[model samples]
Target: MLEQKHYDVVILGGGPAGTSAAITLARTGASVALCERSRYQENRVGEMLSPWIRPLLTQLGQWEQFRQAGHLSCPGMVCCWGNSQPYENEFIFNPYGSGWQIDRNSFDRSLALAATEAGANVFFHTLVVDVNYEERFWKILVRKDGELRSFKANFLINALGRSQFPHTKEKIYLDSLVGVAQFFQNVSDFAIDDRRTLIEATEVGWWYSAQLPRGKAIAVLMTDRDLLPVKPKDLEAYWKKSLLTTIYTIARVNFWHSANKLHIYDARTSYQDSFSGQQWLSVGDAAATYDPLSAQGIIKAISNGINAAHAIASSEFSHAVSFNDYNEALLSSFATYTTERHLYYDRERRWEHTSFWQRRQGNHKFLYA
Candidate 1:
């Protein structure tokens, strides 16, 4: 006979959103299972976290723990957008003070740890092989270490960032934006002082670079997929050539240090047709994804997780439970995000005639992929 376990809630993808929901539900005396695909040893992206994240951590009761994690403090950001002149968006003026530049792997593990401490079953290196809904319960099959485990839950939360299951709705992509990134580790004793993130806009696209903890750093180039001048085989060469076009971003990199190979990932703005259904709902990047320029992906994920947990808890013992408010809030936020994104992109008129800018300026219709 196969091993089978049941829980009040089963969350897929132990990212910020999943762990947030798990921590919340577990604290409320609800049995929760949080499954993560990665083993937590690999490096993940999305390094910068704004100061606004403090409240969310505090709400989850992990603020002090996060403070002691030793992540680098980000005082502000430096941008060269709209024109050649660089400007500072300092955070010292804000009441929350400095944000953080973290090792994403460690950050995520911390959240999962919090969930476990809150009485949730946290599973790593677990892959969801199948999902089915029947008889008012979610039947999920997961594979871990050559063994298959079955789980049944009264409610399911989809926090699977960027990767959706077969039951989820299709994602409507607003654009084909992608990011080519490279990570580096300082092999020698090279002292550097500037900690603010750098964003330099060029005719082709934009560049983002930041200093991470432990003498590590990352630099990424954002551009439309179709706008890439070279094919996949020549992407590394193209990445280097594009770096030469930047004014300030180039100064932030140390070519002499050992760097990882170029990594390409989707950085587009997209949303699902629906966010919630009967006994199931999506959260974080699974429901909607924002452009990295907003720098609110993780924040949005944590917020969604917390909200979803409440919705589930409220409906657990009642048949009249409704997720309409949750859906409406997500839609409203997306609408506002779209408008703000348009205005931000419009600010860069130097590359108006370029295909990359033209698509973002509403000259091109949204394409389905």
Candidate 2:
């Protein structure tokens, strides 16, 4: 048994939000520790960063590091929204300039490494089994490198991409969006179009295809949970049928053939009833999740990371208040995102009667459940 450890703050989950908060607070002289369970052994899908994220990276003092990492430049996005002809939203229109199509595994690892370099103790391959709040501090039990360890902190940050607090409850689930993807080898040879990302709205749902740095490309279908083709053969057949609904994807999937298997993941939107308590705060997706169509997940997570640190510093350092301001602001943002999501979804009138579309149109709701 290792001896107990102590820090001013402890963060769970070493992805962008946790690492970003650690970098901000540790540099300000706070003792910070972050626990991360894996080194990204699975395939991740959120690989595109919009141009608006460039300034946020600069604020994190990571712009130069991100530039030197050699990620592919994202030209912009092309969408088949209300009509069949694709509309282009180029990066040139963004004030912060070019976006990125990243290899998420390398990008996330870089952020974690940067946090350690900023003086935060980082525990890779560690899982925090349970957290107990007692007498103005949190007692965290973790399994680290095949050993159990104990740690204590005055403030805890949940960046685990899901709520881990008893005080907070999910007020509502806006929709049950699902993202199913397939990767094909050697796709660059067949794709002669501009390297920009392609998104098309179909009868059943929407589809996304992006060119990667290697000779590969990833294509995903976004629909509701109820629409997922569960059976092995059915999923394959449905994916092909959905792809064929769009002109941009018909040729792309046909080029690869139906050889690779599909991977399905949650892309739902929901907000916690509360975002912060006196001793703990939830940042990023743990606080609120957005639709994948927004392309704002990465930016929101990094920005929230910085905001969480600021909220902590302002209150406890001044001995004035708790985290109510943080909670209010997060809730406000969630409301605005919900409104915007509905507007974009309303644009696709072709499949209004379908279950996937009906869910987004706000026709069905177990509101406040």
Candidate 3:
């Protein structure tokens, strides 16, 4: 038999968004419960952090913890594009501070453990089955050990990444976004030569390669669903071969000889939902997701989580005002990133001698206002 429990807040999903929110609320003396369906050790990409996340982690006092975890330090980015003739540019983001490349599994679990240490009740391997909202509270149903258990909370946070709730459908559709990544070990030799990470633009989309703290390298390829015919089962093979054919990648083949050791990071789909609802709020990918070409996944996730926590703790609204504020912030961030991407893409497109480059350079669908 399962026991009944009550909390001031119940957060679904234990990724950066949920854990950070729980940690913040717990510090404010609120009773919080976090539910994560997957085990903490699950492997995933989105491990690269951006320059903007440093202050938030510092404020939360977790900067030292992240450093101790052996995250790769990245001072900036180097981007290359075009074929027969290519233009390469390096942007050192040192003014914004150096970012870290993490083992997401370890990083996420660390956040969850931090939440626990801060007094948030943390539950792993527990899946949220259904949510029933009432006039004063919410009834959350979960399946544990083949039995259904229910709990109540004064507030609920829908941090369920990529899982759309019933009310979220009309707001946004994520069926268009696509992402794929891989991890390779024994890459120390390449690390010494390629001091900074590289982002190469290709026909399908963009690709990123960076060295991890271990003697490993992480490479990711991202594009829209409309451009590629990738099913879940064959996504690995499709991404591997597709990446190898890119002109820039072929130029740097020597650095990728250990490609055979590649471990596929599952290709993922995502969408952005308008942040508006009562008694429930969505943060991180649950609210909005940018194309991975921006490499802002974890940074955006943690930043939004911190913002959501502040809004929830300080808000006086009974409805969705707080969530609306969060949405505005995210849109602003995305706007800046989209602008930079277009600039790089346009410059590369103009330099190419091939038909593919001409078409890509002409394609301006992602241009931002």
Candidate 4:
């Protein structure tokens, strides 16, 4: 076993939020240790990067490099939401121009690399098994390839996406929404019209498909967990049946040569009762998760990470004022999100009779479970 190391801040998970927080703290001369469970080789699902990400990345000194990362530029979106007919929503007049369809493996690796360059110690393939607080510091136990190590920090940051600390407040899941998705290969030759993301609403749920970087594409069916098949083997059949129900998304799926097996992921809206504690705080999905329809997953994660880091840097780990302000901001933002989500779901009345749509039609707070 190696000697226990102490740092000013210890962060869990190396996704956008973790890396962003590490970069912010490291640049301020704070000792930061970031732990990630993956080696940046896995194919993570979140791909859409909104146009608003440019300002956030630029603020973190990573915009110029991200621009040269070879991600596909998404001009706009083609949505068949409230009505059956599809329409174009171009970004021609937007100040930030177009969004991006990124390869998560590469995009996430780049962010971790940036954090390393900023002087943070990044541990890949490391899992945090336990955490304890004593003597005004946090004690973390981590394991990698059967080897155990320990770390101590004055403050803690959880950016583990959907995963949360066992001791923190419980996550209030808004709905039982899940995405059954599949990836297709050899799609670089897809039509220019297919370059934009396609969103089609159906009676059962909604369909989202988009062209990905490196000659690949993705198609997903978002619906309630209870609405899916009971058996895992029957999910493909259900997914195919759902695909047939979409008009525009099915056409986009046809362009791909072949698809991999189906994978299910939680796509629900959730938030914790509190985002911060006495000496720790959560960011990204760990703080609050949004629906895919908002296309703000990455945007929100990075924004919260930067904001949280600034709050931490403004005062001591035990200071209540900055943490209080951070908590209040997160709650205010989540309240606004609930209102907007209800309005968007209410826009689709064609499926009002279905259980899936019925759950989303009323007040957003009522949907929480």
Candidate 5:
């Protein structure tokens, strides 16, 4: 039997949320352990960083390191939803600043490593198997190298991404099937003048394309559940077929090169059990997930982690208040996103001639707050 080690806080999942929380808690002189099932350098989407995250990164002393890693700066977004009149939204990140288009693999790893440097014990290749609360502490079971180990902590921060935890009946959110494609190639000729133009093609959910460093372009496609099958393996073929069915997507493909290599990412949104016990608090996508169309994934995750750390660092009563406040804020954010999504669909309904727009426009379930 392995001996159990104790810590003030134990964080599961080493993504942005978990790392951020670990770093924050460690900085406060709390004993912290962060466990990750996979290496942080895995390829994934949701790479577009909102300007809102810049302040937090700066506070954490990571902004300079991130910029030194050679990410592309993005000023704003240009949106086209199967319509002639496209919408443009510029972000004033600072009084006068811009956002970024990052390589997600490098970005995620760097954040996790930063937590380690901040004095948090980080374990990669460790899978959390069970979580139980006993007498005022969380007892976490983890499998590392096929060996079972246990750890005790005063509090547990669950930052496991979507669908990582066991599902329960009280969780009410439905799953959304989102398909994405990315590639890295020398496409300087096809580059748009505005780096922030994340194009969208309605009938499908949305598509964001941006230029990265080293003459590379990243294009992501998000499709509705009814239009695209769940978890299609051959994403290139599916993307080509989706483009053929929609005129808007066809124009988008025409704008880019046909020869570029394509990398695919499949994403989903499911309800999370936000709380397991008095000492366990779920953060980031572990607590709740949303559609990628909002472009709030990274920012939201970081914010939740920071909030969780603050709560855990305070007294017990303060922790409960913070968690309640976090939940209320998340609810408000979801409501706002749904309202905007519906409005976008309403605009698409006036312009697009397809069943995709019709179905989305009439989705009464989308208005749930």
Candidate 6:
């Protein structure tokens, strides 16, 4: 029989949320284990880290290190949101200087590695296939290095992105949100302003495009499924055709040569009905997934992990109410954000007659796959 290993906390998924939680717990002299199933990140979409992320990094004691990673700065967004004419929302207006546009792989790896640097035991290529309560602890069966290993922990944290955990029910705030994206490399250089992130909304949907480091650009369209082309065989042509419909993208992107396979991403806004139960809790997308418009994924995950750790470390009286408070607070905050989303979409009256805009007029809360 294999000997069972134990830690005070076991964090599943080595992404920002789990790793952040692991780092926070380990800092308090708690034995924490982080099990990451994959050593690699899959195809990821463009990520625009908000200017507010500066303080979040500072709060986590990773400002210097994150800055050293050398991601490209996105000073502002050139938006053609509700009108024909484009406008700019500069991050310079904020107290923080600029935001970041990252190659998603590098961003995630930095945080996970940071957790290891903070003295948390991080196991890569490890999958927790089975989880159960045994002897008042979380009994986890993980497959690592082509072998099985058993782990026990007083607390278990799920940060496995979305739909991976069955213990908690997820409530979808906006169900019909998804994206189709294409990557362009060796893109021609335009004016310096062309380097800024670009957003333009059409009658059927909206488009987001940004120039990354190394002359690469990521352009994507977000819309309801019904708004997409019905034939998969026509998807390639449809993608290029639709991208050309954008006010800014048509002139900026070369559809003739830049045509490539479209990558579909699930962009639903949602949250688990319950964030914590017994000795287990969830952080990041496992707890809640936000609208891409909010751009709060990284910051919210870090904040959730930090708050979860502090809550667990508080007095008995405080600890008793911690998770509930956390859940309630996030719920309230998301509700407000969804309301704002409704208002934002409402501004585009030209598309009000379309199903896309008409649907958004309703409170769109539905199940996401």
Per-residue accuracy of model 1 over 1-369 as CA lDDT, tens digit each: 677799989999999999999999998999999999987897788758999999999999999998999788999999998999999999998788898998888889999999999999999999999999988888999998778999998888998988966786678888899999988887332534688988999888899998887778889999998877666888888888989999888876844368988888999899988898878889999999999999989999999999999998887635346799999899889888888888888889998998888877854333223
Q: Give one digit per residue, the lDDT tens place, for model 3 in 1-369.
A: 557688878888898888988998888888899998877765566555776677777777788787788877776666665444444433363565676667778888989999999999988888888888876787798876567877888778878876776557743432344556566667765444654667777766667777766676677776655555556667666786777767655444446445543343323324454554677777777876655656776777777777777777777424444466766776777667656655655676533664434443544543222
Name the lDDT of candidate 1: 0.88
Q: Which pairs of residues collide in candidate 5?
A: none
Clashing pairs in 6: none
TM-score-based ranking? 4, 1, 2, 6, 5, 3
RMSD of 5: 3.5
**TM-scores of all predicted structures:** 0.95, 0.93, 0.82, 0.96, 0.85, 0.91
Q: List the candidate 3 regions with Cα displacement exceeding 4 Å.
A: 1-3, 82-96, 145-147, 170-177, 189-192, 229-241, 247-273, 316-324, 334-344, 350-369
Please identify model 1 stretches exceeding 4 Å from their true place: 187-191, 317-320, 362-369
**Displacement of the residue 224 alpha carbon in candidate 3, Å:** 3.5
Best candidate, TM-score: 4
Question: Compared to the true structure, candidate 4 yields what TM-score?
Answer: 0.96
Question: Whole-model Cα lDDT per candidate?
Answer: 0.88, 0.81, 0.69, 0.88, 0.72, 0.77
Backbone clashes in model 2, listed as residue pairs: none
The TM-score that candidate 1 achieves is 0.95
lDDT of 5 at 13: 91
- Per-residue lDDT of 31-68 in model 6, one digit per residue for the tens? 78999987756756747888888887887788887777
Which of the predicted structures, 4 or 6, would earn the higher lDDT when compared with the native?
A: 4
Stretches of candidate 2 off by over 4 Å are 163-167, 189-192, 256-260, 316-320, 362-369
Candidate 5 on 307-355: residue-level lDDT in tens?
8888778854232433666666666666676667667657665435565
Report the lDDT tens digits of candidate 2 across residue range 307-337.
9988876665442358877887887777778
- Clashes by residue pair, model 1: none
Q: What alpha-carbon RMSD in Å does predicted model 1 have with respect to the real structure?
A: 2.2
